[model samples]
Target: MVLIFLFSGIQAYAVDPEVPDSEEAISAGQSIFNANCKTCHRLDQKLIGPALRGVTDRRELAWIKQFITNSQVLVQGGDADAVALFKEFNNTVMPAHDFLSDGDLTNLLSYIEFGDKVDPAAAAAAAGAEGGEAASSGGGIPNEYLTIILVVLVIVLVLVLVVLGLIVSVLTKYMNKNDDLDEDDKAFINQKTDYKGIFKSDGMIIIVTAIVLAFVVKTAINGLYTVGVQQGYAPSQPIAYSHELHAGQYEIPCQYCHTGVEIGKSANIPSANICMNCHMHIQNVEGKDGISPEIAKIYDAVDNNKPIEWVRVHNLPDLAYFNHSQHVVVGGVECQTCHGPVEEMEVVSQYSALTMGWCIDCHRNTEIDTQGNEYYDKLVQLHSESSNDALKVKDIGGLECAKCHY
Candidate 1:
């Protein structure tokens, strides 16, 4: 009887047609999740929302569907589960996903269920092995080693030229001694070989003057170009913060610190409270002394109700009106597009020139991503109707002077 029951349970779990099984569905679900849900939900850990792993196992399929479709309606309807969940999350309302089809919801649920079943250690090991293989395959000679090789080659070439010059000089002197050339011819050869006198000639002076003037003009042009640009401007901050450690090693998201990136004009500097979120537990640095002095600075500020005076790295002119949300939330620009490889930076610096020309060039080149954004649907349709070519940002009002300056 126990064997019969076990067999029945296995059949029920395995034969569910609603459950997503294909790679295509899972990939689509992942894309959908990254576009819509990643700002709040994580698979194994909590962010703004609860950890989503095993969510399908915890809730009924019907209940999960309804909740995802319209949580506000469920809450207002006084559904016990919905109300309880809302209260548990400090009344943070889960946005309704009514636009998601039944298939999409099923796929998303399947991904969550599959994620819960995956062993973390095994996944990590697989990732590490893949990374090792990629590094081994793609790693070329280091730039420093290449530079050393080039220097050695140049020195060898210089030595060969010197030896050739000496040989030619010896041959000329031997020919002169043998009386193979006339006296006037010998004197002419001697005068031609006088490099010091040649350098002091009017022709050489003219060439030198032209070269110097060209260099001066080039330098002046470069100086003018860099007048207001602050690319690579790395300033020391009040506190020691390693973005490489936090963002790269620890895998923390950029949006976690710069909370305003998706909603406001600025990707605001994280407050001391935000620092305490992690540093409260992680007070000490690994492979170092007891408590990290750098982390202690955050604690001190929190204790004294003071804000850490973090130095601003990227800045824009007052005349330009750049909105963070417009680019990040609407345009869906990656943080790395403007910030460069910040995860690799020990100390963050201004990566882009942030000049008017830079902005114009980007606007001209960038294509509008109108996949899920309803706001661009009409604009995209209009553009397609007007032109057979792919719609770029410049096709819209992105290049208008008033859009940025005014």
Candidate 2:
């Protein structure tokens, strides 16, 4: 019955010519949009780039495809519309998505044109539902609003201080006019605080000295703890290879390049031959004539039989042992779970802290996938008997020192 409904729905679906109307295509396009375009462009709203909802009406389908694939190509070739857009956006280089195929682009356009559509009434309802939280969370208050709020707060605080001063002055005058007051009462009321002298006293000096010393100690300890943690480390490679184009925009399977990830302890660096498999043919891009400088480096390395001296980014300590196969294959963890979005990064950086605490936290939280594993059958049964909760990695020997240690 479900299959019949799905088939009927698909059959009933119809979109514009060349653009897909199917649920699958639209869903795929949404994923693609999230991965690449969401950073700069929005479908219905203007972001860093223009709103892209009605781009089809503005430009031909072929022109849209060309511009998306490589906008600079069109701009340099004196395409009037492309040049205007480039100038309008202050010549912000929209990263080349030549990695995207024809089908991918068509699906993307389909989503831009047809997906996430809501009528005026529905939009109003959604706006009402979102009210306060949306207003607060939309990148905090605007800078101008924040500045105004701060100024108002300062003014109010100053006004309060002034009123307090006036009240104190009036009370002091009233107290002085009282002839019934004793000598001790008048002396107490007239007493002046020596703030400067108090600060210069031994106790105040000791407190300030201790606070400064404590702060220095804390900063030193923090620096020591961060010695091995290279969280955002990004080193330049010998050859400027872009993971954004390959891993992200192109949707290349990570396992295709990093072959040993599922099979071995180390996800070994891909050889030049693996690069040449594609680059041997794809020497130029963006309708260019000569070989690209970056691609030339690859060709040179291949011809000379010398390995490219790629700089290592994520380096685990010698004491710590990490196995890619254990986490990726056995545990079914996504690469993005640890490595972050390598597809979006032009130069890949170390996304995770890769610290002991981080690993332990992940193990404690991540559920163990025991399905189809004969070894886990007894363990799962035992775990089920002990606790109603799903079996986690830490519940097994995941937290055990020997599990990760040599």
Candidate 3:
């Protein structure tokens, strides 16, 4: 009993007499504290102000609310209790927040009462919104998947057609002899069996002629479609060059080897001097038992031991006038964009068809990075007014025949 009394005495001394015990009062205090008090005071740590971790344990909620509402007022009233606290906190005066509404104050207090607990409902709602956005942002379906589905559909259709054909053949063979058949039935029978030299018969001949005509028309259409097409053209080069090597392992910059990219029309093949730049140091290489065959070719080309013959890899037709700098430097296209991931290639072959259609398709999709270039300011303004964010090469006169031909 004596120890209990001692403990109670200490607790009584800690709490202010003015404070009240009420949930509403504590809630009201909390809202105001979060909005204003949170800027300086944390529940446990001394940020700019003293920690309020166990303030409720130390003082009555009512007293705390009174101090919160107006600490200066309590001090002015000669409240030794308030004065002592102000002195204890190094006379650091807590500011009054007159702007906070009663409801706002209540919410702030509720947060303090609950402390830190994850709200599952809020988390779930956020996750749902994120998932919905991700679903919306994705393209409808990948082409490969769509193609696979289409192929399966086609295969199913073909199987159905073949089965139907077989069924018709069997039915015709069985029913033709069994019928005192009608004219159409007899004709179908004749078509099916071709018995008694049906190929010599007029109707059968007409049907065959019609089929031959239809085949001819389809073939003509297909031939027209392929007039200027070169789908699988693999041209021979003078050099046994492997786009795979220089582009693949070494990651030699395309422009470094193709030095004429920025300054002139072609991404010209490196001269013997450029080859010597690296080859001089790399001669008698380590990889394949020294004396690298490829590097040796460069040495021979320089005529240190007679001029080496280098076959040309890419040769634009004389009729077409193309400028590498216009596309590479001005347009800002990487070599690999056209050449296709050459760094991974051992022997570089033309990845793109490089046809007019291919070029136009690329032009249609590519966007220009015109954010800060003063040269594009006028063009950008025009585009902004036109409501087109994408700037294709064609929009910048890239597709004009004169641009390529002249």
- Say which candidate scores most in TM-score: 2
* Angstrom error at residue 129, model 3: 70
Candidate 3: residue 297 lDDT (0-100)? 57
Model 1, residue 54: distance off in Å is 59
Q: What total of clashing residue pairs does each candidate reach? A: 0, 0, 20
TM per candidate: 0.45, 0.46, 0.40
Error of 1 at 112 (Å): 59
**Per-residue lDDT for 144 in model 3?**
47
The parts of candidate 1 lying over 4 Å away from their true place are: 1-229
After superposition on all C-alphas, the RMSD of every candidate to the true structure, in Å, is 24.0, 20.5, 27.8
Full-model lDDT for every candidate = 0.78, 0.82, 0.64
- Supply the TM-score for candidate 2: 0.46
Ranking by TM-score: 2, 1, 3
Top lDDT: which candidate number? Answer: 2
Q: Over the stretch 1-406, how does candidate 1's per-residue lDDT look in tens digits?
A: 9568545533544334576656677677788777667656778766556788667667778888998898899899999988998997768677889999998898887666553344457899777665444433124553444567889999999999999999988877877787677888888666556789889999999999998999899889867755744778776677789999999999999999999999999989989998888876785777753355577577657655778877567777788999999899888899999999999999998898888889899989898888887888898899989898777888888889999996
- The deviation in Å at residue 327 for candidate 3 is 1.6
TM-score comparison, 1 vs 3, better candidate: 1
